[model samples]
Each structure stands twice: as C-alpha cells, then as structure tokens.
Target chain A: MASGDREESKCCFKEWMTTQEEDLSELFQALTVEPENIDQLKQLAEKSITHFQDYIKRRNKLAHKDISAYFAPNWCSPWENSLLWVAGCRPSLFFRLVYALSGSEVESNLTEFLLGTKEGYLGEVMSSTQLLMINALQSKTISEEERLTMKLAALQEDIADQPIAMIAKGLSKVGEMNGEVEKVLDNHGRQMVKVLEEADGLRMNTLKELVKILSPLQAVDFLVASKKLHLCVHNWGRQRDQKLGRKEIDEEC
Target chain B: MASGDREESKCCFKEWMTTQEEDLSELFQALTVEPENIDQLKQLAEKSITHFQDYIKRRNKLAHKDISAYFAPNWCSPWENSLLWVAGCRPSLFFRLVYALSGSEVESNLTEFLLGTKEGYLGEVMSSTQLLMINALQSKTISEEERLTMKLAALQEDIADQPIAMIAKGLSKVGEMNGEVEKVLDNHGRQMVKVLEEADGLRMNTLKELVKILSPLQAVDFLVASKKLHLCVHNWGRQRDQKLGRKEIDEEC
Candidate 1:
C-alpha cells in the first residue's frame, strides 16, 4: 500500500512496454493454420492483449488512489511481454502471407523502448519525427487487398482458435447487449469494449470467409444475431413442417 | 428482450418449485453403496453438487431477471441435467450412506421426496416442513462417529484427488494478502480491529490444519494474512527461509 511500492510496480509496466516496441521483432511471426498449432500463438496474442488490459486497469486504479488494490499476490503483471508476443509475431505472419513483409525499425525500436529490453532503461529507439516518417512510409507501401487478407487470415487462423478469445467475445457480446451491464461489472471496463469490438469484427470477417461452409440453419443464426433478424431466430426451433418452403421472399423480409 | 418472456422464464423457477412432493419409488427402494467403491460415491456427489451450484446460480440470475444470462448452444450442461441426477441417483447414494453409517432413514419414500424423485421442483422440496422435520430428526440422531468417519472420509478422499481444489487453495493462499487490501478499500466500512479478531480465529483454524504439511514459512505466510498481522503488506517476497522460529515474544520485544 506504500506509494513507493506503487511507483516501483508502475516501473515494471513502463519498462515492459518499452521492450515490446523495440522488439516488434517480428509481428505476425507466430500465426499458423493447423488447428493444434494455432492455439499456442493465439494464446500468446490473448496474453499480450490481457497484459495491456491489466496495465490499464492498474493505471486507472493507481490514478484513482486505490493503490491498496493488491493484484495477484501484488504482482503487477508486465504489459509489454503480452504485446510483444502478438506485435511482431502476428503482424509478421500476415506480411508473410500477403504483402512483402515490412518490419520497420521504428516499430521494433519503439516497441523495445516502451518494453525496455535487457538494459534496465534502454536508449530511445525512435524520435517523434522518426515515428511519423515510418508511419508515412508504411501507409504508402500498404494496399487494401493486403490489409484485408492479413486481417482475415489472423482472425480465422489465430484469434478464433483460442478459449480466452471466446471469453473475450462473450464479454463483447454482453456489451453489444448493453453498456450498463459492462459498467455494473466494473471489474472489467474498457477492456470489455476492446475485446468485444475485436470479436465482433472477427466474427463478421470469419463468417464472411466461410460463408460457403455455413448451413442454412447456421446462416440463419448468424443473420439473426448480426442483424437482430428476429424472424430467422424464431424459425430455428420451428423450421420443421415448413415443407411449403422454397419460395423466395424480399431480401429485407 | 421481451419483459414478458423474462418474467415467465423466472416464474418457471418459482412455479416449478411449488409442485407436489413425490414419495420414493421402486428405483431407490433397493439402492446400496459398496464401502470400498468410494469413486462412484465421489463422482455422484460432485455431479450433484456441480448441478446444484448451477441451479442456484441460474435461479439467482433469473430472480435478478436475467433468465437468458447463461444461455449457450450447450444442451448437455450440468444446469440441464443436475436435478435429474441428484433426484434420481445421488439422493439414493446420500440415503444409503446416511442409513448404513448412522441408522437413519434407509426408506426410499423420504429420500425420493427430498430428492424430487416424484417431481423436480425446488419450492416443493424446500417448503415441505414435514419432510424437513423428519430429516432434521434423522440428522440429529446420526452419531458424530458416523457422520465424521463416513461422510468426512468420503470428502477427504475426493478432496485429496481434486487438482482444481489444490490450485484453488494455492490461488486463495496467494490472494489472501489482497484481502487486507480489500478491507482497506472501504475506510468507513473497515472495522480493522473487528476484522483482525475474526481473521485471528480463521488463521488459527487454517494454521492448525496446515501444520502437518506446510513448511514453517508457508505456515507463517498463511497465519500472517489470516490474522492481518501485516502493517503495510507492501511486499512479501524471497521466501528463502522456511522457518519463522517464533516463540511467544514479550510485548516489549
């Protein structure tokens, strides 16, 4: 509960983030298609995201002077370790599949600076102009097809295979229901939104990718949840005896 | 989404609970448990307990008007099957165990009625004063040796084998330090001295139980939190030394 201890713990998260930027080392470095192998990489991405969330939660609690909130034996889980796993590994995997991979020195160095490598406090890897310059170069180099392909590939291959990913999705779905529920939980705040948006987007993208594989029932479920298409949901339990079916209706209907 | 649907679903809980109590039928009339077959009893007990917890959680959620809270496509969950399992098999197990060990009611009628053998309704089983009164009499008649030696023996055997239980204990131990922090979270609500007294008793009980297996250091960690013996609890690291070597120091020391 000491302010000194809180300051010390804050250093841990600050240093971790510094390290991740320096090490963007190989974003997309870890995506795979095989079901079993995908789990580990997917887990690493989740861990990275969770670490960021934990960092944010800790930052807020500390800022609010709830410094006595002891987190897991008072362990301030390092946020950068989480990000690094996904940052370089996941982005690199996408580049490998789509665009000729671009691993920027700014991305890597900034990550390391934020996450703090072996050096207790490493050198500044990139300046403000340097970061802006790198962003400009990346913007010029990237194309829409490349972006969409990598994004969809990551969603289908890496994100969906994770168990924690589903929890992230479930939390998101709850948000889609109402913000009051999320606020009442108070246990997890904005992290719920981040996870939900990611899940919602990923679900849409993946379903679109696998539209050919979906049965009529599965399609109905997706459409119902996505569009809040009430009638399709009702039909889930009563599709039988609709033998008078096959007549096409208006698209909205 | 529908207010009427929400109320009706919850009404299902209270309404279903208010059915007629059914007497034990032929299914349980010839029930028996082999003494060495502890595994079967443990499985049945755990299954029933898991189901019971889900039922309680579901009922509470519905009571809070969130009937669809736990809905998944999952049809074979404990929530769906627990009452039937408890009413049908586990209740029989409990009856046999009680009867054989304590000379309590081995009759199927009361067991069936209590377990919902006739009908699976929470209100009926819980509201029946006559059945409760009979069970209370039977429970009181059970000797300490019968309950402790038989019932506790079953629990110990199961608790020993449960990996999750061990992990939960470890997590609880690690989380204990945070309990003090939680108390500090509410300044007006925190009656520190009162908490310290209760913590002392709980610590003493926990310490006595762990004395046989825990290292001296582990025991100290446990007792320290249970008793809220820390001033700041700012840090608890480097458990290099396993022995605390305490010997009732004088107040001056």
Candidate 2:
C-alpha cells in the first residue's frame, strides 16, 4: 500500500469519529427536546444508523487491501485498541448496554422514592418481548464470536504448517524461498480478510437488530448512550495516552 | 506513542529481523560447513535464543505503555498481523515446524529409494522421547493460547458493561463522563498488557523447550529453517502489500 493510501485510511476513520461526535450531539438534543419530538428523534436515530452503515462500507473497502490495519489500528489510542475485538466493538455489547441502562434506571427509581416497585418509567423502555429477543441475539452473537475466534486460532496455527513450512523446505533445498511462498501468504491474507468481513457483518447486524427491538424514543436514548460511551472512551484514551507520556495522534490529521 | 518512538519500535523490530537474516545465513553456513562445527552451532543457537529474549524484554517495556501496538504492530506486514497471536507468532508454531521438517524428511527418503524405510537420517532429528516432550509442550502451549483468548473475550465483553456502562450513566446524569471512567479504562489496559506479557513468556518458553529437545546439529537445522521462514514471510508480506498498491514503510526510516 502506498503511504498516501495508508494516510487516507486513517483519515477515513478519523472522519468517521468526527461524524460520531456530531451524531452524539444531535442525539442528545433529540433526547432533551420539549414536547417529545418523536419524529425528530426517530429521524436522528435512523440517520445515525445510516451513518454507521456508511462508515462500515468505507472500512470494508480499506480492509480488503489492508485488513490488519483495522485489527490494530494506529488511528485509535492504545487503550481503545486493547479492548477491540475483530477490528471494532463487539456486537453483543448492545445487549449489555440495554441491561445496564435499564438496571441503573431501576436502581435510581428505588433509591429516589424508596418504593418496592418492580419497574421504573424507563424500565418499560425494553418490553419483556424485546428483552427475550435481545437475549437470543446476544447468545447468537457470542457464539459467533467464539466461532470466529477459534477460526482465528486455527489460522494462526496454519502459519507454521503451511507457508512457513513450505518456505522452510524450499530454503533448505534451494537456498531461497520460491514464488509459491508468496502465493501461500497471500491466500492466508485473503482468509484473514474474510474473517474480518464476517466480524463486521455481525457487528452491523447486531446493532440493527437491537435498534429494531426498541421504541423510537428508547432507541434514541440507547443511541445517545452508545455514542456518548464511544466518544468518551476515545477522549479518555487520548488523555491516558498523554498521561503515560505517549504522543497522541493529531485529531486534525 | 510519539512518531519517533513509534519509528524506534519499528526500527527495533527491523533490526531484529536483520539479525534473524544474519542468523539464518550463519545457520545455513553451519549446516553446510565441513567438520560439523558443533561448538559454533550450539553457540549460534544459544545466541539466537538470547536475542529473542532480549527483544521480548524490550517489547515488554514498551508494552507497559502501549501493549496494543504489539498486538497490532505496524512493524509487521498485514499478513504477519493476520497470523499474530498475543502480539507475536503462536508458541505452538514451533512444534508444527518441527513436525513439518521431520515429516518432509521422512517423505523424501521414502520417495528417493522406494524402500519402506522405518526411519530416515533426519527422521531421527526428533527421538521418541523428544517427540513426546514436544507433544506435551504443544498441548500446553495450545491450552495456554485458549485460556488467554478466553480472557481476551471476557475483557472485550466487559468493555460495554464496565467502562461504557459507567460512562453512559455518568453522562446521562451529569452531561459528561467522570474521571472514574478513565480509571476504568486504564485498569482494562493494564490487564491487556498482562495478557500480552503472558503470551510472550509462553512464546519464549516454547522455543527454549523445543531447542532443548533437539541435538545441536538438529537444533541448528531447526533454527535455520525457522529464521528462513520468518524472513521469507516478512519479505513476502511486503511484496504482497506493494502488489496490492499499499504504501510500505520505508526501510531506512
């Protein structure tokens, strides 16, 4: 890849992050607006989802040539990279967020009113049916993650037995690696890209499914929370990097 | 990390690779040299191991601040990153290399003479005892990989429930994330560094044990093969990257 192309990919991700900040601000506005502007909230929520889809599309294009870049993206902070799975956040995170948000709301209501209520106002944010569906989606997503992880393990193992082995044998005989070795490595790269694509597919599907399960207002709240967490983590990672005496990436770049 | 420091890490790794190339050349020279310099071969093999240990130590220090860089290291090619386990190649890969080299020797001997040979010259490169030991080591390494992978999975899942959830709650209440959120992320980063350290330990131990299991000449052969494979894959990855129109990091830089 050309250095220019690499910079382009980094810029692409940075732009996406900037868009995320904008989306979060808009989401917060929708959440706090008077008269419960349901149409505005719904439109903003859908727009957020569309924006995510577009970002994924752009990422997929870059990943086809350099998927490893995403897996260990230099654009993100070390702290953020440490938590990454398959190049981005885990899809099942949405379920955990729902449970956490609902649980927190319930706890706050109890503390405020001292009532033994089973549910809070926001508790109905997720219906029992929605919870069941989300739970099922979570199970499926987790299992998919496990499957991809094992596949990755196998791929890592193959590194020694396949290309490395062939190259070793060729070197021992001919004093150099042959062209076939390159082909083998390229094949391996293609498989890695496939695993990455599958992972991205799971992430996108999980988000869409979760959004589908929520009411427009609830979805806006969830979106607001999700974006807030993302932006917060990014900023926090930058702060931690600075404290650790690490040079942070230039946001403008 | 500062761009210069990042460049230093890359240079550190590149220097290591240059050493590997030199080592491979020496190993092959040792293999083909007359009078079979056992002392020289053993010294070279030991030096190779020591170099690896030193590299790991240096990497560990860097990882204390930016362990994620190792996991998704830019110093390596995308192909190399695709196969990385815990910031480097899998420890179990050594066992596979032993098996492949031994298996190929056996096959070539069988085909050369059309005789049902019980054991070829290189077939005994690993004795029954050594094979048993290596098998044990492989199992241990694989199980260790599994454990680390599971730990990573848990860590990824915790991202949403721990830091993200807390940040979300804090933002909803106070219109901003609190300092506590950064602490949570810092804690997660520490755990990640620990996991990377464990993986490096496993990799070093596996190499040491495998070397111990082989005769000096056999060890030289194995080392030669290993280094050749390493250099080949790295070069292959770079070529592939170039062919894919990706920007390659300048070698001098």
lDDT of 2 by residue, A73-112 (tens): 7677766776677778877777777777777776767676
Residue A194 error for model 2, in Å?
A: 1.5
Chain B TM-score of all predictions, in order?
0.23, 0.88
lDDT of each: 0.27, 0.73
- lDDT per residue for candidate 1 within A18-93, as digits (tens), equals 4343222211233212223544434543444444445555554443332112221112111111111111112221
CAPRI-style grade of the A/B interface in model 1:
incorrect
For model 1, state the Cα shift of residue A202 in Å. Answer: 1.0
lDDT of 1 by residue, B58-168 (tens): 444343332111121011111111111111111122222222222212233357667867311112222244345436543533332233223322321221122212222
Model no. 1, DockQ? 0.02
Poorly placed runs, candidate 2 (over 4 Å): A1-8, A34-43, A111-130, A168-179, A239-253, B1-12, B34-43, B111-124, B127-132, B168-181, B239-253
Instruction: Compute DockQ for each candidate against the true complex.
Output: 0.02, 0.36
Clashes of each: 37, 6
Misplaced by over 4 Å in model 1 are A1-184, A207-231, A234-253, B1-253
